[model samples]
Target: MYETYTTVIGTVVSDPRHRQTSTGEPVISFRVACNSRRIDKRTQEWIDGPTLYLTVSCWRRLLTGVSQAVAKGRPVIAHGQIKTNEYVTADGERRADLEMTATAVGLDLSRCVVSFEGAPGREPSVAGTTTRPVGSEVEGAGADAQTPTAA
Candidate 1:
């Protein structure tokens, strides 16, 4: 069977959590919130639509880029497959949630700060990308943080 999906652009509502898989691969998880405002004809004023909360997961090569470029409340654009994930509780109960296995993620630097996260041993420079370090806030980023250096 085939399923339909939609793309969403918004801000990161939470910090990205990094974890290592049992096999030792890196994965990062974070949430993004997309809100929309619409005018109610009867009220003649803008009202908030349902906020979309997506759990985005990034792995392998993209992991580090996501960690460095994205942060809480930072605008971003994410595109990927969307699906509901189910899990079991300790009491044997069932739980369900939505997630997006992000194939592409980047900062919406239209009018926000750009930063680079430096992981241990792996310097930001080695990535061949010029960055201001994770905590350093650079205002008015053009796009995709600073231009990435050639591989």
Candidate 2:
């Protein structure tokens, strides 16, 4: 009936795992670590706070881009619906995993500089076709047209 959405800004903690589902749909999953920080008002010094870790999953067409773009230790922003995976351990302890089925993910530009590169294997579009390559510049396609550059 309701869904919870979250946006996480953090460093990628693990390399993206790319695989196809049993039905042959592409998917990519990765972990991220977000830590809290605060500046003490009186001392005016920044201090580290607790860290929260979460797993992010991207599906379908988003998989290729996510797999190629994300890597361990890189800062990224991920947004998606939050889901809780609950289970019981062998020793009878209850545990939960925080995961997000990511609708979008990208580099955290505020923390680092990054260059945009077009997705590989994209096909060029022809006239009257609605599909275009990930980063192709179409002549006379209007102001939104973007020329892909080498990173």
Candidate 3:
């Protein structure tokens, strides 16, 4: 199944962890927290919901970018596919984790500033070089939000 997923700009709630798979693939994973506010009809006030926590996995070039540019408590935007993983714990309990297999990850420069790794004669720019906006939905690219499942 093919899916596309995107994440709202948020803070990295935890330190990123780098690991190698059984196949020796390098991967980095981190958690981000985003909060949304909606107005309460009766009270006519805005209230926040439980912050949404998304696990982001970076691979290959994105892995390199994330390692170089992202850190705990850093503001960032990640776009990719939402992966729901089901597993049984050692205690025999089943758990599910929501993760994003990130195709694009970047430092959100709107609020706080982040320094990028500078190579000789090069300055990194996350604006135009990093990601495509969430608004641009690619044709036939089935996003996780649009996908149907047996739930």
Candidate 4:
């Protein structure tokens, strides 16, 4: 059988819930709401379209980074395997939930600006020369060595 993969770009609708599995593995879950907007040809105005709510789950090493970087109302992009959860309630109604085991979660650059802080064990590249830790001043570059502020 072929597995399905998908990418979702949306606003974080809920705070990330981080927890440890029974085996001591870290995990995080969060909700995202994706809404479509279109321009009306007649009025030349933008109108809101339908919205899709999806649950995103991050596991292991990905969990900690996602939990720290994402927050409620923040725009994010998630991509991974897709799964549909089905369940029945006491009322005898069946409902389906769209979920993804996110392999990657990142801020949606189109919506907002972001500063890239170097991760641990990773080398920071400045002008393709020397490697330095995040927030360290680069030698030889006078005033331009400063970190650029996000607009």
**Cα RMSD to the true fold for all candidates:** 7.4, 8.7, 13.1, 7.4
Off by over 4 Å in 3: 38-46, 115-151
Runs off by more than 4 Å, candidate 4:
22-24, 119-151
Lowest-sum lDDT 10-residue window in model 4 = 124-133
lDDT of 1 by residue, 72-146 (tens): 867778888889989999999999888988888876656444444466697653233343334345467555566
* TM-score versus the correct structure, for each prediction: 0.68, 0.72, 0.69, 0.74
Tens-digit lDDT track of model 2 for 1-151: 4699999999889888888889988888999999999999999999989999999999976665676667787778999999899999999999999999999998776765444434468753222112223344466766434443212
Task: Put down candidate 4 lDDT per residue, 16-128, tens digits, no spaces.
Answer: 88888899888899999999999999999999999999999998767656755677877789999999999999999999999999999987777764544454689532222
Screening candidate 2 with a backbone cut-off below 3 angstroms (N, C-alpha, C), the clashing residue pairs are none
Taken over the whole model, the C-alpha lDDT of each candidate is: 0.73, 0.75, 0.72, 0.76
What's the lDDT of the predicted structure labeled candidate 3? 0.72
Model 1 ranges off by over 4 Å: 1-5, 110-151
Choose the strongest candidate by lDDT: 4
lDDT of 4 at 64: 52
Rank ordering of all candidates by TM-score, starting from the highest: 4, 2, 3, 1
Error of 4 at 87 (Å): 1.0
Per-residue lDDT over 73-94 for candidate 3, one digit per residue giving the tens place of the 0 to 100 score = 7778888888788999999999
Worst 10 residues of 1 by lDDT: 126-135
Clashing residue pairs found in predicted model 1: 116-134
lDDT, model 1, position 61:
71
lDDT of residue 96 for candidate 2: 98
